[model samples]
Target chain A: MECYSELTCSLFVDGELTGDAARHLRDHLVTCQRCRDLVHALRAESRVLTESLRELPEEAPSPEAFSHLGFSWVWGDLAMMAAVLALGSTLFIWIDHLEIPGALEWFNPFSLNGLTNLMFNLSYYFAHGGTAMLTEYVAVVGGLFLVLLLGGSVLLLGRRWRLPKNGLGLLIVLLTFSLPGFALERRHEEFVTIAANQTVDDTLLAIGNTVRVEGVVNGDLLAFGRSVEVSGTVKGDLVSFAKRTVVSGSVEGRIYNFSQSLDLDGQLGHSIYGFTQSLRVADRGHVGDGIVAAAGDVSLEGEVKRSVDMLLSGNADLSGSIGRDMTVTGRGLTLTNTARVGGNLTARVRQLKGVHIADGAIIAGKRDVQVRVRKSQFARSRFYFRQALSFASAMLVGWLGLVLVPGFFRETTQAVGSGWRSLGLGIGILAGVPVAIVVVAITLVGIPIALMLFAAYLTAIYLAKIWVGAFLGWILLRPTGATRYDWLLGLLLGLLILTIVGFIPYLGGLVRFGIVCLGLGAFAWQLYHASRPAMTA
Target chain B: MIVEVEEGVVVEATSSEPSPLGAVIRMEERAQLRVAIAHLPENYRLPLVLRYYSELSYDEIAQQLGLRRNHVAVLILRAKQELRRKLAHRSK
Candidate 1:
């Protein structure tokens, strides 16, 4: 018989050979020295192979070794989210309660006329507020929140996602220095004083008890103090936030002032916009452009080369020469004998008798007086119609979300089981993101990012209620045979319920806020969980 | 000359003649052989390891690998051959 095949010898070494085969191989090996050597070598090879494999480490470390580390990391992410949320909500509530100067006091939500007035006032403020409106506290807090959010996200998510380590380091460094506190350290000057002979070529920022500029400033002047006095020449805009602002200089650009009282005794190349308690233009004051002010009392004794628009809470006394139209909405208006309006004079006051014009006061164009009237917003059919339209639009958005990302809703709804946790996360994201966006916008280079963030923030806010509505609908219906259509039906019912609750005077606002918190929290929770690495083998 | 195995002991074909090859492998040679086996391909390595390291029978290896009984035997033989070649090349 031929020598046993190496395959047969290997099987024999493993003791896998059957009775007849094993007996034959053993008999063959004894007679053939070559086969015997083959058998011996095979057995030795088998022993070595088994020992080597047994000594080798597993391909991946056992899951038990990493389970604890992974769990802690997940909890770390959750804690970070909660902390940021709490801090953000506190800041938001504080900012909301702040009594901003020049804010409309006649902002009656129950009147359509009041809404129109609010829109007009908001447009005016946005158009003229300029950089002075950006509060320092907001900028600082926003910067800090931005750094924490971005840095935390990268650090927490980077390892699991295997993001490039070098890039993460660079990003962390960039986020650290982007804080407004760091930037302010280099640019802020406390108790700034520019001497008579001094000239500042770069934009000047001064924040202290008092800011006095007596020389030339080639760039914009930003001053925030108890008292801001500028008796110099400003080649660019002058933005001042102070208790009292007095300008006796020539400003080549516009003037934006938010103060208790603003006195202009200088030449303005452009417009003068002031949100103040009292604003006065002295006899020597000359404005090349228009004058726009929201003030308690406005007295113009100088000359304005363009129109004058004033929203007053007390009264407007115009003794100066206005080259264009004059529009005043206030408690009362007065035009002295020296007052000269080259164009139309329009006054909207509490009463027509509140407008007093001297016989000698020259108005070259039409003079119109409108008596203000209060109307109930709920009385108007248009209000209900508008509300319906808004409701429909919201429903459309919710429907789209449901259709396109059903999985997302499922995940969010699942997270809603942890209610308080979701609420905390929700408050943080809602309040924190806007502040971060504002801070980013303050940095000119980050404007695009700010815009994108703003869009996302608005979308999140709009969707918050819808997400909650869907969850509510699902709970109430609890269809035995659930389907896509069943979810839609539940969504409709839930939205209807929410809408009715939202119409309930005082409780509506509170319920709406709760729903938003719940929805936003659940959404954020889902996102966090989704970002976790897949640990299952 | 005739050789026969009555039970476990080997009776040489020629009386008073000892075995030509050494049955016992040295510790260093066994270590070297183990390293060679580790370097074997997955198809060969897996069955070889399963058979020896795991102390599985041919039927068990075939069940794990989803292969025929005879095919497993062939793979193990190839695995041993590859390991021998590697060890020989390393010694050179």
Candidate 2:
């Protein structure tokens, strides 16, 4: 008799042979020794195959090898949240400083009667000022977000391509050299001077120990030096980064100054924006537009045709005329007798006693004095409302994360298994990044990199809580067979628990901090592993 | 054929008891099997490994390899046949 097919015997041994075929094979095996031996051989072969394959050492390195380090990928939703918060805060500060007519009254959270009122006010603002605001801020914010998203996607998805060690350096170099309008005149010397009679029709980029521009620069003047003295006419903008910047010449365009000391005795057709230790607008100096400065000390004796917005750490003394609104925030403010304001005068000081208005000081419009109050942030209902808003925003972000990168989201949550290691790494990263940022920023060449790092740092901090929440949710729901939208459910439950825990008076902060540390560490660990060359299976 | 049956019985007995000498022999056999599997063509080896090592079902292996379920079974069987032939030839 013909022996049963070996394929049937293999299938039978694998428990894949079923129904009548399996029954028939079993019945035949009772009588046929040859077929029985074939079946036995196949079973033995299967056992050997399984044992040999299972006993083979794993090709990939053990996860325990780098369990001490935590990893993280830049999450899109977190990035978006960071971007929106940054943009909103900047806009609020700008509007608050500019004291735009009626804008503050609408945004006053304390004045709102209830949630309905706040919502109504917000909707009203969106309806009325949305177009102007969106056009001004949204375009820039959207473009930046789009670029970030694209870059992040590439980094996350492009596993096949590896960036070389010096890739970022190469990119920076290429970008610097390949910028549009690369025909600008470059000057680097110990003491560079554009003599009085000379005329430069093109933009002048200068770096020196002391840069003196006494001649005409028909275009923008980009100056970097220990001391920058611009005594000549600059038809275009003047951007100066120096220890001491003195502008005694007429500049048709805006003046952007980053210096320790800025003395503006020159005529400025537009605004003067300065980040300086001390800013002085001399008696003869005049600004056609506004003066926006963040300085340690501000002495404004000149006339500003538009507005004067200043954030002073030390003191501000204004004796000159302001064409429109004048807003000053500082330790102390002084309005001299000769000080004249065409519009509103708003002073924000630590104490009302810090503001001094002379009897002869003229104000054409409203004079509002705001004294800073020190109180517990949690005491305010607005604080709770803000917290609720934050929770909702986080939920939205978490949902987006779950929808976009489910695999990564799950992996990141699972990575939190090494709790102590993640916490330790998180603590290191949280404390070390700022120090690294400062070091990088000190090298002016790395300013862009420093900014990028700062953004990433903020994004990571915001994302830490979400990661913890997701992990918590997973842990709680794992026994329930969390297979469908498990991450979303986990995130929701985890975030709710975290929020409740955070409301606990004294222990809440400590618990929250620990959670953040764990999340950060896990992310860092995952990020490190992700960046490594993947092991071939 | 009778000798092959006796060899099968010895293998089954050795695997169950695994004495020191039997363990050594089993290790050598496993090493030989690994080499034979590695030498098998990708078409057969992939399905076999996916079934035995990964512990994937035939349907899953078919889905992963984008082959029919029956095709996956056939490929696995062929892979085992090839491995057995290699091992037998080496022993000879």
Candidate 3:
């Protein structure tokens, strides 16, 4: 037989090998000294790696190892919580003082989907203190938010590293951007119009019934209206939230469109980030970057310098020159003869022919098409929103973790250092814990303990992803000096990817499961190794 | 791109063995590993640190670094070889 490839052997060591290959490798292992030696060396190095890291400065390490950030880090966290409380308390009190009834009608059971409706009504039934159900729901969700915030605070406080400069500003920006506002913004109610010859320099945040931008805007053009039209040139970004938006203008930057129906005939210097009901790019349009669109009906007859990624519940027709990749997931997809792709064309449609490609179409790269289950627009939107929420929350948690126990965070991630051993332990813990909880609960005497343990376990599982995000962040950002901000950037970038990946159909769930397993595995693996279970042995 | 160039430099600098032996192998503290890692080229260094230090699987490392799985293995192997040579040279 052929000598096992190093990649294969490496995968084998990482426990990423499968049935026949693994068996074959094992058989070869008995006969191959070189392969066995390689394996031995890998295992030995991994052990030494774990041991070497054990000498890292812990939050409370011995004198010789390294110094801890005991006081300053803790004080920084306390100071942050102080600020959050000072602001939050005022907001909470103000909200409570307000006599606004039906403002939270969106949270009402009837307004929610069937499942959430049922859950909300149940809470309403159990609001034993005669308080309004809406008030109670708000309070409960509010309490959960606090728990998440305080839990993050407590986690950060446990660490021993000072917060980065401008942490407060970063925190506010993260919180505000991630949390979608349900509160009333009456911008869409007014009838605003920018005349044909007008020129606006700054970004326009307008809300109106019928708004039209016909003049040049040096800054970003943002409008929320029933019928929004942009026929002018926007030197900056073009952001529109409307029922029907028609763009015939030129945008120097990106186009962010959140609309019911969109029609574009523009010269865009950047990409188009759109979430729409029906989207069409006119034949004259040109996109400098790529297109990331989630819409119902999409037809592109434009030019894109890079890739085109679309998650659609409706039909799609493409007639564009994609410089790189083209990934389309939808009910139906058509690659018109004009669609000439420089790279791969990956489509997950309802049927093989749900994606129709004309004979004139030239795909220079691979053409892969897989049929997929289509979800309701409502379901997909909700999923996207929840993912955004989860990503935001993880940022909060990771930020806290990085600040609190920077060393511990670093070490926990390094636990991934143990390779297959950590993965196996992670798998065992993730799969075994619930079973253990059930077994303990069967005795009834261990009920409270089991429940508490279960709660902590769940929290640990949630934080595992955050920890993984942090690890990813640290790896990506090269530290010029120990004084840094890369971890935060890494976390945001990594979690953003994780959240986006979690939106894919069948593959999304599988990817998330792998991440969870890896994270949980890394956490457990780190913990076990961190304890110096068999030091110097 | 710059990182890839660094890895090229490190690969050329490294000697025969993929890992160091003798006294240089005594990396007692994580700081020692950092010092050793500093010798590696930019590209291969992150992959090596991620694998040996972070305990990240080859696939995870690849995903994080945006490299192919097989490429990640090669990078790791090259990285280890370079690190071994650098540490040995340093010790001498």
Candidate 4:
């Protein structure tokens, strides 16, 4: 209807309009010079955006973003102070728990009640229970402290002080630390009977978290996970469904790996089978059998012992050698200088990026490598890596600033301490409540409350160690006269002490454990203190 | 001989067969027949196919999946047929 609308319609056909409203607005563009000009401007803007989109960096969230989100130094400083106080308190608790301890058999997380009962019974019969109790208290408290410190250090540093990040990181670290226990616990809880003498069926074994097969399979082997690495040999066809599938071993059988990323580095005795978003074949490896792969990005660096049939959704780099024949269908295919092929390469549709063959590089067969220029996946990875590096650097800078500025450090530490105290107390109560319920179910009397109190005692010891470790890390980072008269040297010296002393054998462990306990204690105190106000008010 | 697959026949195909596609169709036809006889659920198909080719027997797979004997056989056949056709189309 309008001249501008016609231009806008043309722009939309040329891939300008992203939303339905933009498409609908094309009607108004035809009648107005302003709208026509707007369409032209939008077209120019689109081109600019597309060109620049490839250059945008993928980075971690910058430390400045965190600061902007409001992680004040006051919180951190309080955390540091509370941690210091808790460490001292934990030492006293540790000594007290050990000295008054009866039988230490109940100190483990597994069978607390029965062990405690045994300990009390043994205390009445023999004085040996006191020694055992002391040993148990020391071991349990000490071990838990290590877990907490390791978890917290990873949390504080890995998250760069975001509450959600810290919590998630800590959970993962703790879960990783408790993996062996968790695995056993899962097995115990889920299964009633174990099938003995049942050899893992190769096919049944195909579906697993991690499967490494060495023999030939009579059928297709489906493998998948965060990482599925096949380095051994496979007899039958291999098919994987995963994020990443790496094949470094020989596959006598055909291989089909469907993943986000796939790698083939060994000889495929049969036809190579693969469909990945990104595919790579190593230089030393050979696909004796023909290959079929579909990828967003395909990189061929090695020898294709046979024919290669690939449909690249994005861009492909063909550099290595192919024996019989090669055919690539993609947005763009680049032939590198070192690439070699014995057979003709034919593509029904080919997009060429840049082909650079060296003087010495030989194409024994026909020059059938076709080309059509189109945008591809490499452009995207470049953009992402740049952003990631930028964010990481920014966060690093923020952390360095927090450590360097004394006032800032004090404030942040204080906030962290207050948070830890509240969190610890809440966790302690939550942990105790379950045990109390179970005890009451069994005893049907006042025994449940007593049992809960006992559970709280154990949990407190563990949490205390975590807080103390963190506190020790901060306090130990004092300005020592390492470099003569240099302020920078003093800062470096503090960091050095914090890292080094906190990792040493006996002394570090004790100090770290103490800090952790203190943090836990502070958290418990805060929770109780907070809850009391609501009850009273 | 080129045998056209009826709407529902399952075929089994191995690399050694004259045509991988033909064998796959056979596997599919057999699987379809089994599924009807056994009256099994749809979800059991993939695991059953994977188990069939591997060292697992019908009984073992049935036990693992918490299913009946006939259902496993049905699932395995159906899965075999589906995979063969999907893979054939994908390879092209």
Candidate 5:
């Protein structure tokens, strides 16, 4: 019979052999000294190995462990997100109909698509209330933002890229140009022209000289010459400062005027107020509320449905109807035959002429008239008080995150920013190879090398985005001192400055694409560096 | 206890003699020891000297392992031989 092998001994130990077969293996062990010794050694080694395994660390020991945020790490997070979303949705759906007032409102009965819209609208509704609602809105928005940011970060960080030296050099040049103060003045214009008829959005539409509108602007309008006319309807408010300002069309909202002469010929759906040097209103125009002004000459040929308080240097003309009250302090006053003062009229005028008041003109309040010839008794003496209520809502999810996962934010931020280059490089490599292969196949030998180089370049894009995302997240979260906040705010003032300003057809695309490439390159460098050691590990 | 064919009384009866029945009994004993050792975990490692002394006679192991006679003699005379014997006997 053959000698019992180590394999046979192992099988016997595992109780594979039965009855006499097992007995036979057992019999061999009584004589074979070498086999016995080998088994003994193997047994001792196994025990030690098992014990050592028990002592392995539960978590990554070093901070540098986070220096390489890989797919597995992010996949774990994604899984958590999916779980939480599921739980939240389920809880909301189950308990929403129970009428738990405060929380119940969040449970919209609408379809899933409608729920998003509802949530958006509900947030806007709460936006009007005090800081509490604003706070809640910010919190929700910040959370949504973070999830998206992290998702993108993961994708970007995992990429890699390579490019030709010249391409790299060009990227560097573009990055240098992207810095502030590289070129300050973007577009030069004292007066910009808007065509006679064109549709414009919220963008700064240029037309004529020295015409400024700070109202709830709707569509586009034409501006021409020294006279500034807003004849077209404005869905939003209108704010203008001009030599002579005219609003012939309807203003759905408030109108703030800073001009030498102000004229409102059309109806104002809301209030109209101004601070001007000279104010004039044609007979066809009207004022929705009281008019406050400091001017040289104040003339109103139209109707004032409410009150009017004016201070003028030369003269004041009133041919319009005053519904409530009229107060004027000017050098001279003139009331035409068409003037009908429904309410009291208080004035300080040097001379009064053509003072015509129809017998039927109702004057409910006491009427007093005073001629103030002195130049010092101007309208600047009166100040209209306004309530100053400031609103600041910062949606801090970090505090929440700190409550939930103490180290998640800091760790994630470090992982994203520090490793941005390597991560981007990884992604570029992952994406580039297949794309390059496809290109190579299509173009044959003509593009194989080029495709390879392009693949290298693309692999670095995610690195750039990861770094930018981390910086943006940090900047957005930093509760630095007031001055730091101010500085940061100032720094971010141009978040989309290039986008808005660079929309000049072909040049815009070039500039933006160039900027994008530079950003991608920088991130790619960071991600590439970050990802290397991780790959080795 | 004192049954012997040649010169010495067989102590501990670790293996059977040259008879057919003795060979079967010796094979069974050898297999038992192997089973015990094989049951241990994969990472475990026993001391080589202890294992060899407990499992094999000095002359047989010396021949197989290419060790000198004096070395095996010395290993058996030392406390290592006694420790292995006691451990094996206790385990069984």
Candidate 6:
């Protein structure tokens, strides 16, 4: 503690040290001039290095992102499904043997070879024995399932006690890892149930009026019934087509729900693709690849590993974790303070004011209105209020963008120096790109390519003003004669200027349009110049 | 370890060392550093790339690499040390 450690210095440089340690170090450095200087030097060094690294701009969208999600990804799940079936039949015969040592004992009934032969026969049945073996095993699995379900339901329902969610989730994760098979329940009248204690070896198809899965299904679960309740563990895809679907268990695969109302209070192994009148993914829910939810009032209180695409008529209340992009087409959207979206948010909301995006809701990606972008209703002087809000929002976004990837902003802003050239390039690109896209789309084969280019074009257009703002910020801050550019201040002043001027009438609109063209031109100029040498090389 | 060589060879190659905190954030420098990093051992490379380029936290890097969370920090520290050494060596 006498001398500040280099390890601490490194962590400090990375801004990782928090709370007491950071506080202590800062206090210590106050009296210790030498250490203060050292810390300063390290900060400077790391800042420069980080800035350079950021500029490397490695977060470029991968070409693979454009590729269609193909069937190749599900091949592993299918193979696992086949294996589960083989194991389930053996379990059935073993349980049957335990109950009655003589009844249905076709092999050498007392020996290990007898058990081995029984399993071998089950495998033969899985491969060639057909529907008979499947039907026979389902009866056994279904029987045990009912027994366990009834027992648990009686005890738990009687006590009015629910199992702890975390423990249940962990238990399901462990149980579902062991088996994979196809469980067939084609009863037209009976309410089919897969118990909590039961483990289905493979894919499950429960076709009944009301289906309840409370067991651990080792394979995919496909239930087509009036009401479906899944409280069990399905290690594969959970596909339900029912009037009301309630998933209160863990699914170690994608969930495809098509129902009137869908309630998810479980952990999803992969993504969710659902169409429902109303959907609620509860706080305890966790989805791996995000969700493609087309519902009425979708209330998401869960963690999504990727993005969320919501097509909803009613309100969307989101207070969860999103790993990437979130696109919403809804009447209203509300993001609680606890909500964190790691990537961009594009909302096509009917009214902007109804979309209550609270403080502490971290959206790492750009928050832009894709379609039907409207100014929120301001209680004060509507024109001035909107401008002020725009300035503040844009400034915050610009600062965060710079902090996240300084290189991108740095490069874009650099183009502003060649003012006329950049403006020319931007105009050319803005005009030419649409035509190119249209021509490409006509080919049909190049549709994806055209769409991708269009997306890029839109992004560039959106960012065009940002470059102009940054440039203006730079010029304003230049007189400070500081070596490094004060980009934050530049961005703020520029955004304020842009926003305030936008409050003007027809002239303001014309001015904004001119700025867009100029900004786009500059960006294109930079891109062209930047890529030329590399392309030639 | 190679300070003597750095003083004699690399010192002459560059006009002078930058101010402790005043290294210009240059694209060329990034390219040079990246090229230098490409020469590092595979074990060091992934952690460095993920830590800096990808901006992954220690826990995330650990999970992706299937290493213990604490181990990721250790790897990052070692990787930086090695990177600095290699950059100096390449400069020579």
TM-score of each: 0.53, 0.54, 0.38, 0.28, 0.28, 0.32
Model 2 residue pairs with clashes: A70-A524, A70-A525, A71-A523, A71-A524, A71-A525, A71-A526, A71-A527, A72-A523, A72-A527
Error of 2 at A172 (Å): 13
TM-score of chain A of each: 0.59, 0.59, 0.43, 0.32, 0.32, 0.36
The per-model lDDT (C-alpha) reads 0.71, 0.73, 0.65, 0.49, 0.47, 0.65
Task: Answer with 4 or 5, whichever has the higher lDDT.
Answer: 4
Kindly indicate the candidate among 2 and 3 with the higher DockQ: 2
Indicate the worst ten consecutive residues by lDDT in candidate 3 chain A: A57-66
Model 5 over residues A1-537: C-alpha lDDT tens digits?
457655455335433447997887667767877766655553443232222222221111122322332344456446656755665465445433333222212222333433564566667676764444433343344334333333343433342123136655754664454332222211113443233463335423332454334343453222322556666566656655456778876666666666677788876766667777777777878767667777787778887778888877777777777778788887776676677777788887676552445555445677787644445322334311110110011112323333454333234434444444534433343333443343222222323344444555554342322223434445665645533343334223323344344456798776545444444534434342343222210
Ranking by DockQ: 1, 2, 3, 6, 5, 4
Residue A66 in model 3: lDDT? 15
User: What is candidate 3's CA lDDT for residue A373?
Assistant: 59
Deviation from native of the Cα of residue B70 in model 6, angstroms: 98
Best by lDDT: 2
User: What CA RMSD would you report for each candidate?
Assistant: 16.8, 17.9, 22.8, 33.4, 27.5, 25.8
For residues A166-226, write the lDDT of model 4, one tens digit per residue.
Answer: 6567557655653432222111111111123222234322323445544444334545344
Better of 1 and 6 by lDDT: 1
As for candidate 1, its clashing pairs are A85-A428, B2-B13
By the DockQ metric, which is better: model 1 or model 4?
1
Off by over 4 Å in 3: A1-189, A209-211, A225-227, A241-244, A320-325, A337-339, A342-344, A360-366, A370-537, B1-92
Predicted complex 4: CAPRI docking category: incorrect
lDDT preference between candidates 2 and 4, better one: 2
Candidate 3 residue lDDT tens string, A185-270: 22323566667787776666555667777887777766656778888887888777678888887788998887888887878899
What stretches of model 4 exceed 4 Å from their correct place? A1-205, A214-219, A347-353, A369-537, B1-92
Off by over 4 Å in 5: A1-197, A201-207, A210-216, A219-225, A351-364, A373-537, B1-92
Candidate 3, CAPRI quality class derived from DockQ: incorrect
